[model samples]
Every structure is written in structure tokens, then in C-alpha cells.
Target: MEMRSLDRSTLGPENGFSQLLKPWPALNSPFKGAWCVVAPGTSTTRHAHPDYEIFIAMTGEATLSSEGEEITFRQGDIVHFPPHTDHQVINDGAEEFQMYAVWWDQETAGRFLERHDGQDGDRDGQEG
Candidate 1:
């Protein structure tokens, strides 16, 4: 088994986050993991990708904006985002908001989309 640690010191200023695990052929990982810490009054870029993702809140509270909807989540809350869904996290609280993010490979996401087609309405997986 491969073991990795969460090292905040490695977090880059450009992303305010650090990648923990990723699809490495040698490691045989099919998913990616990241540890993110959003400073107060800051927010992550509103973006989307062709990969299924889930975010687990570790501390503080934040507002998750996705698909034109805003949802509030606190510590221990988990949120899932389907592939191609635009999302952004805003740390409106005084303390920093920490979250662990995991996303599956694009191939896996494609298969999931095919299986769930039209179940949640048409999702062309394209940005508007």
C-alpha cells in the first residue's frame, strides 16, 4: 500500500492547496486527492472538469456555488459534484475553511455519465 501525509507546508500559493495522490502508472491510482484550505474572505476559482468530484469539509464553514445554486456546508459536511458542473467554494467565515477533495479519472467519469444519462437531465459536459 502507498502511504502519503498531508503536508500543509507544500501547499502552493497559486492554488492554496496541495495534491495528495494522483493517477500515477507506477502507483496504479485511478483517482486524485487534494487538501485545500481557503482563507477567510477568499474563494476558489469557479471551474469544472470532466471528472466526478467530492469534497469533505474538515473545518470552518463555506458556501458552495454550483449550477447557479448556493449551498452552505459546515465542518464534517460532504458535497458531491458531477462531471462538468461548475463549482466554487467561498470561505465567508472568519476562520480558514479546510476540505479534502477527491476526483475520479476521466474514463471512470465518462462511464458513469453514460450509465446515468438523462437521469439528472441532459448534461452535455460542456461549459456554457
Candidate 2:
């Protein structure tokens, strides 16, 4: 079994947040997993990709913007993002916002979308 840590020292800045666990051939994982942290008053870039993604809020609170709507979430909340939808997250709280994210490959997302009748299961997106 492979083991990894989410320690701050292991993360690097990407876009506008600190993240780690990016997918690579050496990882041998089917999907990408990341530990992300957004500082107060910061936000991630609004972006989209052809992969399905989900985020688990681990600390603080933030507002997620997607498909013309803003949703607020806090620790213990989970959010899903459909492929190709533009989305961004803003940390308005005083503390840092931390979350765990996972996303599947495009081929896997395509198959899942097909099974779901092409209706986007969720209306948010994220950058790898």
C-alpha cells in the first residue's frame, strides 16, 4: 500500500491555493487526489476541465461560485462538480479554508455522464 502525508511542507502553491497529491504515473492511482488550502480573502481561479470532481470541506467556510450561483459551505460539507462547468471558491472566513478534492479521468467522466443521460449531475468545476 502507498502512503502519503498532507503536511504543509508537502504542498505547493498552484493557481491561488496550496495543494498536494497531484496525479502522476508514479502514483498508480485511478483518479487524482489533492489536499487544498485557501487562505482568508483568497480564491481559486474560475476554471473547468473534462473530468468530474468532488471536494470535501475540512475547515473554515467558503463560497463556491458555479453556473451563476453561489453556494456557501463549511467544514464537513461535500460538493460535487460536473465536467466542464466553470467554478471557483472564495474563502471569506477569517481562517484558512481547507478541503480534500478528488477527480476522475476524462474517459471515466464521459462514461458516467453518458449513463446519467448527459444531464450534468452537478453544476461546478475545478482545475486539476
Candidate 3:
């Protein structure tokens, strides 16, 4: 991924219940980028990215966990995870959850994303 401003046009729609701003990243571009926002009371299926991911919440709250620690995150909170690590995001709020996720491949990139086709990921619903 190349270095771009916060207003990257290629990033599609906002993700969550609110007007979530993604400004997402490109594939195999040599950079990891943030794909932002998940709706409140909703959640993305548990999963892992090929590059390290960072979750930033600007509004509402979220239930996020890695390993055995489960925590709720609110505004001004930033969560970081390394590649291939398990992570889950759950919107526990009543309103929309606005978030920004920044991913990096070289640990020096503006953003990067490794799409997992439901292979290696956070599977909260598929567990025994």
C-alpha cells in the first residue's frame, strides 16, 4: 500500500451503524491499511489478518478480545494486534460505532490487509 491521506477515495463505504469511514487499503501493495468500523450490537466474525491490525473507535463502544482477555472499548481507544493473532470485535453499544483500523505489513507502511477466505480467523460462532 502506498502512503495516502486520510481521504483515500478507494476506501469504500462506512462499515457500522453510523457513517463509518473506512478509507481502506489496497491488496499486495506492500502496505497495511485500516478497514474501519463495525456496527453497534453487531460484530464481525472472529478472524485474523495477514498483517498487523489496529482498531480505533471514535464513537460508541465495543467488546474486543485477544486470547483470554475480553474488554470493552470506547471512544479514543486503540487496539493493536500482530499478524495471525486471533481477534474479535463486538458492538455492545446502542448506537453506531465509528472506528478506524490501520494495518501495516513492513511495520513501516501506511496500511495493508491480508484477506482470509474464512480460513484463519476469529470463529466465536464455530466453537464447541
- Displacement of residue 43 (Cα, Å) in model 2 is 0.5
Worst 10 residues of 2 by lDDT: 119-128
Put down candidate 3 lDDT per residue, 53-118, tens digits, no spaces.
787788788888777689988899988898898877777777766676766666444322234322
**Per-candidate TM-score against the hidden true structure:** 0.72, 0.74, 0.57
Clash pairs, model 1 backbone: none
Residue 17 lDDT in candidate 2: 68
Q: After aligning candidate 1 to the native by TM-score, how far in Å is the CA of 50 from where it should be?
A: 0.5
State the weakest 10-residue window (summed lDDT) of model 1. Answer: 21-30
lDDT of 1 by residue, 1-128 (tens): 66677777777653445456554444434467788888899888888988889999999999999999999978999999988999989888899898999889678656556545544344665432
Candidate 2 runs further than 4 Å off:
22-27, 107-128
What digit string (tens of lDDT, one per residue) describes model 2 on residues 1-128?
56666778755667556565755433444467788898898898888988888989999999999999999979999999988988888998899999888889767555554544423333334221
Runs in model 3 with CA error above 4 Å?
Answer: 1-30, 107-128
Model 3 has an lDDT value of: 0.61
Candidate 1 residue-wise lDDT at 7: 71
